[model samples]
Structures are given as C-alpha cells and as structure tokens.
Target chain A: MSKQSLGSLLIGMLIGVAVGVYLGWVQFPVEYTNSSMQALAPRYQDEYTVMVSEGFLVDRDINAALQRLAVLGKENTPDYVQDLTERYISQSNFPAIPSMVALSEAMGRLTPLMEVYRLPPAPTPTPFPAQ
Target chain B: MARSPRARNGIRWLALLIGLVLGIGAGLLYTWEIDPVIELNTAPWQLNPAARENYVIAIALSYARNQDLTLAFDRLRAVAPDRNVWQLVADIACERHRSIQIASNSDIIVMRALEQLYRSQGATGCADGQYPTPAPIVFMTPTPTSTPIVPVGPQATKTPTPDLPTPTVPPPVATTPPTSDRFILARVQSFCDAQLDGVIEVRVFDARGQGLRGVPVQISWGGGQREQFYTGLKPGREPGYADFLMERGRSYQVSVPGLVSEPRSIEAIPCEAQRDGQTVTVTTSYWINFQQQAN
Candidate 1:
C-alpha cells in the first residue's frame, strides 16, 4: 500500500467518527421528559385522546370530557375532535366515534360530518307524583 | 528485530487513537439503538404534557367515586413517577382553572377532582374554590327521651285481711326490636341496570314497586361514619329513593329511622360485566328497599 493511500484511509476514518458522534449526540438526543400534554408527540397525543374518551364513558360528563381535552392545546378543540373523529371513521374505528361526537356536541361544535355517529339523547326524568 | 524508539512510539500512538475511535463508535451504537433507555416504565415527570393530564384526570375520577385518597395517590405517583404527586395535581388544576377556558363539565369535574385530591393531601391550589366537594354526610344517633310516671297503687292502708292483694303487673309494653319486619321490611336486590350510581341506594315503597316519599334513612359505616339522609327529596332521583356513595372494601349498615325494619349490611365490592360483547367495569352496591307494612 502507498503512504498516501494509508493517510487517506486514516483521514476518512477521522471524518466518519466526527460525523457519527455529531449526529448521534447533537442532532438527535434521547428525550426522557415531557411536562405537558401539548408537548406530547403526535402518537402519544392520540393515545391520550382515546383514554379521555374512555373516561367520559365511565363518568358520562360531556363538560369534563371537553376540559380534559383542553390539554391538547388546540385553538378550537371541537374542530380538532371532529377532524379526529373523521379520521377514526375512515380508519374503521367505530367505537371511538360516538364519544368524540358526544364531546363535540357538548362543545356546540357538532358538524354534519359527525351526524352519522351522534349519540342518542338522554332520557328525561318523569316528575314524581306530588305527595 | 530492534526498531527505532521514535518509530515504535509513533506506531503506539496511532494504535491508541484507532482504539479510541472504535471504542467510542461501538458505545454510541449500543446506547442509541440496541439498549437505548427503555421508555416503557415512564415516570410521570417523563410523560408528555397531554398524557400526564389525562392520567391525572383518571386519578381524580377514581378518587371521586371511591373517595380513597391512598389509591388515588398511588395512581398519581405512577404517572408523576414519584414526585410530590398531590402537589403536582393541585398545580395542574390551578393552572387549568386560571386559563379561563370552558371545555365542558368534564373539565370542571377534573379540576374539582384535582382540588379534592390535592386537598386530601394538604395541598392548596387555584382551583380550591372552583370545585368544592360536599362534605361526607354525618348522622347522629337520636337519643330517646321518656317522661317519668309515678306508679299508682291502692292506698297504703294496712291490709286488714290476710287475702293477698291482687297484684297488677303492667302489661308488657311491646318494645320493638332493632331488627324486625313489622313497620318496614328492607331487602337489597341488584340488577345490572340500576339506573343510578350509588353505593347504598335506599328505596321506600309499599307492596308495589312504586316509590314512597319522605322516608328517613340512616347509613352507618366503618370509622363511625354515619349519615342520615331522606328518600324522595333529591328531585331528580326516582321517587322513594335516596343514595350515598360508599368506599370499596368497607361495610355499611342501613336502616330506616323510627321503623321496625331489619338492618341490612353490605360490603362494597368491585364488579365487572359484559354488555353486547364489551366488558364494562362496575362496582357492587347495596340496594336496601323499605316496604312499609300496611297501616
């Protein structure tokens, strides 16, 4: 092997090491902390929304559902919910739609898009007979 | 072969630099891909903001129904990952309340839940007054008062005749037993479709299933927590009915005041059921029905 070739090989190795280290540590480092719902990555945000919907089923509080969703940091939560519901429907996720539509309706943001999955109105209580 | 000192040293220097680079490269590879920090057991502090809020909301809901502070704290800590969990919940609630955003009733409950959670832990927050939890109902046992009457007997005149005076024994004043089926007969029944969320549902009725109004009921539980509540006064709840939330694993004794009814006791237990092929989680409750005997 020629002296020049050996030196070139050494220089290439040095460059490779520097570039690898820079990309691994500086360009993308590990993220171990996220303090707010808005800071969640897109995948995690969806999971959080699903959990909130489950909670709504348990409590059946539409207002509480909206409040928990506020953490999403969307300028218009109802619109976001509607859009998400559409996406879920397109993806064939039927069970999640009713809750999303219910939430949107409570927020006064129900759209025609959500009409297909609207929840049935709650039953009205009959007045007890006067004693 | 004997080599020059300069040449040997140079070679050694080159070898050390190459080893350093290779060693660092291998270490970085492992840390970045193969054995990178596993993100499964994420601490609460590690959760993204939205996920954390959802988690905290769940804790609040569980606490609201169960009124179990320890269980709530444990759940909150699992998300916060061991921080001052109660304080964190309070701060989040305060922040939300101050934001002036009206998302819906859920938000209010969440804030209230957080306040209750934090308050139970001695943490104060901005939402302290926003959502106030009604204090648990407490009932005091009524003390019976009786008027003393002087016993009247024949005049204390000396008994002239040896004939024994007819003794008059006060007819046994029929005192009602604590557990009797005379005035009210309380029997607890359960159905998957109870129509309400109450750990102890008191229903007062006649022979039919129709609701009877204005019946006084007493519920006593562990730790001497006794609450006196009335049926058919909640306005929205069914007539002849009243309810109280109870903690799981706790025993409750139910009775109607001023009535001869058997006291019914029940323990709150966790239960689950399937509806339309979907599993639904629910809790067990005691439905004590009082059937007032005919007058």
Candidate 2:
C-alpha cells in the first residue's frame, strides 16, 4: 500500500471510532432492569423505611420490621430507622411521624424529638384495693 | 505492476468499511461490558425479582395501615404499570406460599396483607384463604364480684356508749350491666355502579357506631354454599368492612355472630347504569350493615 492510502485508512478509522463511541454512550446507554434495593435512590429509600415503620405499627413486630428494612442492605438497620425518624422529625414530615416514632421506640431508637409523637398506651383498669 | 484505478477504489472502500465495523464493535464492548451505565436512581419497576417482591410487600402493608387504595394503586403502578396491580399482588402471595416463605409470623402477616390487597380487589390465586387473619385480641376489664370484707378490730379504748352508733351500711353501689355482644341487622341498601358490580359489602359496628374488626361474617348461597371471612382483613377499607362478589341470578344470605335479626338476603339482579355517557347493564350490589344492640 502507498503512504497516502495508509494515511487515509488511519483517518477514516479514527473518525469511525468517534462516531461509534458517541452512539454507544450517548444515544443509547445501558438500562438496568434488575437491581437490588440498595440501588434505590435516596427518596425511595426513605419511603421504604417509612413503609416498614408503618408495618411495624400494624404487627408490632420489631424483628419483622428489622428484617424488612434489611433489604436496603444497610449495615445497621436500627440505626438507619433511628436516623430516618430523626430526619423526618427535623423535616416535620407529620404524616409519617407517628409510625416512625412507634417503630423507633420498638427498636429502642426513640430520641427526645420522637418522644412527643409516641402513641399513647391502651388504657387498663385500675386494680381494686386488696381485700 | 500498476493497480487499476477501479481496483484501487474498491480496496479503499473495503478498508473504510472494515474500519467502521471494528470501531463499532469496540465501542459496544466498552459501553456494554466495561463501563455500563452507573446503577443509580433505579425505579421500583427496575428492581430484581426479590427486591420487587419486597417492594410489593411494603406497598401492601402500607395500604393496610393507610387504607388509601388510590395511593396504593399509584405506588403499585410504579412497580408494574403495564400489568394488573391486584393480580401482581396475588401472584406475589402465591409465590410466597409456594416457596415456603411463611415460616415466620411476619411472613404469614405478609401473606395475609398480600391476600387482603388482592382479594378485596377481585383478584384470586392459589394463596387465597391460605393464611387466615387471626382475630384481634380482646382484653376484658376485670369486674368486682362482691364487696370487700372488712374485719372488725378491737378499739384502742373501749367506751360503751349508752346507744351504739347504728351499724352503718355502705349505700348500695349501683353497677351498670355489661353490654351484650349481640348484633342486629341495622340496614340493607342496594345500589348499582358500572364500576362496582355484584358486590355484597358487609359492615359491623359496635353500639357506639364505631366499626368493629375481626367479626366473622358468614355468607350462604345456592345449594347450601357457605364461606366465612373476617373483617379487618382488608385494612385498606374500614376495619369492619368485608365484601364478596355475587354471581348473577344468585341470592345470598349474610349473618354475623349474635345477630338478632334473621339473616339478610340479597339478589344479584341485572340493573341498568350509566358509564362514560353510555348506558350499561350491571348486576346489582348491596351494602348490609350490622350494629350491636345497646342493652
């Protein structure tokens, strides 16, 4: 091959590579269909935590709530619930405050901020005087 | 030897095409395998099968507490927009039971929550009625049977008064009788809607008009057919609400425990209703309410 032909081929290959890269990365990027809960965005993660807290209110089972929150792949589930509850309090997310506080109390993560939102205990009859 | 112009042109074109193909392959390899899109901001639908199940379970549980079907539907739509959301819940429940995932109490509750969400929406699966929701715990207040017995003690100083003070008897303490659990058929109303067809919605309430949960509601139909379902199963509605779909041309009877009135009967007769500016034929639906009799 002559020097001119070689130069032309090299230039063509370089241009082709640039087009290909543009098409591959920009025009059509890979889309993930299968992902773990840990991949959830920050907003969704907070929503899931609140849902688990509500479930805790329904069943009053801390272990179950902890297990459900485990899917988030957090290192410490209780601390996560606590921190989220505290965050909600600071942000004044009123709709979720009660359930989150109840779950935090169940997990022994209740902070002073959550204390006001604690659900009142069921009433019990007073004991009669000893005969 | 000197190459022909045409042959040289062909060779140039071939080299360019080869270069393009090679470049495209390399680009795809890098993008797909080496540095694919970063995993972030994944929507609920993109979740893996296990994660999707978890997401659905959370949605069901949230619905159970919040009793907001619209919100629940919106959330489930986020998970799978193209499919039937209620059927999706049913499938999840069936899968859990099939996979032996009901070993724990929470697992069982998860199954129940799933069933409640699906079944109440007219979706049925193998897990239907598999995990019956236990009745809510009832704590009775302790009632004193007899007055406390006070023993007579020797007086520190015995002074015999001419007339001993009349033995005083504590005035009789009036006690109200405990309320009976008897329930009576309070009202039965029939209505037809193009959206909701052939449904028998049963509601039970205490004497105070508050909805009561966990009351067994029994339904009987043709040929002595009978089925029992408990309230509060579908927490998405009122705690005392439970409903059943009725077959066309069938008469159904509903009764609750301690019901004073005879079992209420409803017929699924064809009715006319309007929908989207068009008239449609739909089966009749009834809402029967039971109230505790105040004693």
Candidate 3:
C-alpha cells in the first residue's frame, strides 16, 4: 500500500485497540467478571456437580454412589464440596437414606486417606455395624 | 502555519473534553446502580455499624409498642437482611429489659399485664409461661392479748397460808402485737426438684390485707444473655401472676408500685416432689407495707 494509506491504517488500529481495552477493563467489567455461574470456577462447579450427583445415586444404591464419589475425590477438592455434601445429607429423607452401617463402611474406606490429607472425615450417621 | 497550530490545539482540547465526560458518567453509574446491587447481595449481619444500630433500635421500638411482630421482623430483615430473626429478637429483648423490679402489688399487676401482652404477641424469653399455680394469699394478723386480771380474793387466802410453803407465780411476759402485716407471695407444700416449666402464681395485697388487682409486676432472669421481662398480672389470676420457667441458680426480682416498701428478690430453689410432677423450684417473694408515722 502507499505510505499515506499505511499510516492512516496504523492510526485507526491503535484507536480501536485503545477503545476495546477500555470497554473490557472498565465499561462492562461486571458482565465479564461474572461469566456464567457454572464457569465462574471450574473446580468448585465440577466438585459440587459430582457430589450432588453421587448423593442422589447413593439414595438409590449405596455402592454405586460410593464409587462415583471416590472418582470425584480423586480429581480435586472444590471450595464448596463440604457444603454441598452437608446440604445433600440434610435434604435427604432420614429414613429413606442409606443405612448408617453401609454409609459408615463407605466412609471408613476414605477416612485414612482423608486423615492423611488433614481433612475431616465424612459425617457418619449413628448405628454402625460391629468392626 | 497559523491554521495548523490552531487545529492541533483544538484536537487536544477535544480529547480532554471526552475524557471528562466519560469519567463523570462512570462515577454516576457506580454510585447509583452498581454499589446498591452489590450491597443487596451482602448479608444483614455484615451491615455497617451505624446501619446495624438503627436496625436494633427498630426492633426495640417494635417490641416495646407491641406492634405486629411479623411485620417488625420483616423490617428487621430489610435492615439487616442476613441475620436469623428469632435469634436476633432473643438477643435484643434480653439486652434491653433484663432487670425488672417487683417491689409492690402494683408493680406485680403491671408486670403481669405486660407479660400477657407479650404472650398475646407470641414473644418468648426468660419470662415465658413457666410458673406453678399461685397459692392463696395468707394474711398474718397479730393475735391481741388481754390485760391480766388482778386476783384479789385468792391472793388474800394465800397470804394467810404463808406459814405453809408460798407458791411463787412468774410474771406474764410482756406481749405486743406485731405492727406490720405479712402476706404470702407463693407457697409450695412440696418443692420442685428440677427445672419447673410453667407459670408462677403471685398474689399481691395491700397492707390492709385487701387483694390488689391490676398491679404491674416485672419478672426477669438470665436468658439470651441480656433481656428484661415485664408483664402485668392477668384479671382471673389476681392479685397478679407472672409466668416464668424456674431454672436452678437463676434469681427473679419482683417490684410493685406504691406498695413496695422495699425491693424484693427471690431465688428459685428446687422443692420436694408432688403428684403429677407439680412442684415449686423457686418461691419468689416480695412485700408492701404502710409507711410508719415519724415519732
């Protein structure tokens, strides 16, 4: 291109870059800062999803739920995993939830690993079977 | 050259003007929309100090005036949106009216009335319904003694038999009637062993032994940390009744207007068992007396 045309094109590109940066950093930051709630933090979102899904499965079949949750724990701990677990336990029907014996056996499997990581054990309901 | 200098200066001025306009627009948007929306998501307990004080004041006013509690609670939630209403109310009420004096029958009546008002509004605290049936008011009147009669004839015959062993008679001890009247506040034939969960029947009477109805009596104890309990006596339970759960180690104070010669404090202690588990843990007491004339 001619030098004059090239100079004009360069000035236009500089102005566009400046305006785009300003809009992204200041003008509409709230929208950009809060991406989709699910994408806000992948670790937290994935852990919560896995825990809740496992909790539901546990309601249907204890062994299957334990297997699913074990896979989730192997991935990475999330910021709200404990909160999600508590909410799931509190919301479940007390009588319809898995028997305390089965629940504790599942938790016993994880207690040693959890202790090694200095994390609290999963809440065990009362009435465990004889060791 | 003249046009070039002027045009260059004008471009600089145009950029400065645009920057000023943008800055002002951003400030206004932040203050009006963004700040408020962010604050809305924040919890009530996290409000600034001044806002928290105002919220507490609103709760106190609502409780004192016996306003609609649910509405008061809604207003509280608006002011401090994240606090548990019941826990907040319990804490505020305990702090504001913790100490009540029940010195006279009038105080008892007024306290009972206030308690009923609180009950009607469905507010519970240290002075909830937890006292046993009020015992009958027993008025203790001094038994007057008659003057001793002079034995003239019998003494004269005794003087003639003085040679025989004389019978020595002891002079009658000077007996005076009690000047003050004592009334029964509450009595339990058997005391409560554990915590008594019921109402305490308190009877108040004037020095003349007449039942004093409509007296204001305040009952307060330790619960929720710091709150005062004020209730007036109900009509059927005259002279007055203040309902309170008597727990071990908690002391209750009763005060009455005009009749309270002095302040009365009663510690609720466990009593012996009775049928149907009706026993008194604490017999809270107070008295009113007529002012004596100066010598």
Which prediction has the highest lDDT against the true structure? 2
What is the per-residue lDDT of model 2 for residues B59-134, given as tens digits with 9 covering 90 to 100?
9888768755567788899899889888999999999899898887778778877886776555678997788765
**What does candidate 3's lDDT look like per residue over A53-93, in tens digits?**
32332233344334334433344333233344444346653
lDDT of 3 by residue, B1-295 (tens): 4644413533443344444455555544554455522322333344454334333443433232332345445655654466554445544443434555444443333234334323332345664432222454555555999989976664443445346677898675434324333332322212233344333444443322234455555555656342333334454542433444545557655444443244454566544544456763443322222121111
- The reply for model 1, stretches above 4 Å from the true place, is A1-29, A35-54, A57-59, A62-124, A127-131, B6-10, B18-43, B133-295
lDDT of each: 0.64, 0.82, 0.40
Question: Can you tell me which runs of candidate 3 are displaced by over 4 Å?
Answer: A1-16, A26-28, A32-111, A114-131, B1-6, B9-295
Error of 3 at B203 (Å): 26
Candidate number achieving the greatest TM-score relative to the actual structure = 2
Give RMSD to native, each candidate: 20.8, 11.3, 25.8
Residue B121 of model 2 has an lDDT of 56
What are the per-model numbers of colliding residue pairs? 15, 0, 57
- Chain A: TM-score in each model: 0.69, 0.80, 0.33
Q: Looking at candidate 2, what is the lDDT of residue B108?
A: 79
A best-first ranking of the candidates according to their DockQ comes to 2, 1, 3
Question: What TM-score would every model get versus the actual structure?
Answer: 0.39, 0.61, 0.22
Which predicted model would earn the best DockQ? 2
- For candidate 2, the per-residue lDDT at B292 reads 72
| Model 2 bad stretches (over 4 Å) | A122-131, B1-13, B135-295
What proportion of true contacts does candidate 3 retain? 0.00
Worst 10 residues of 3 chain B by lDDT: B286-295
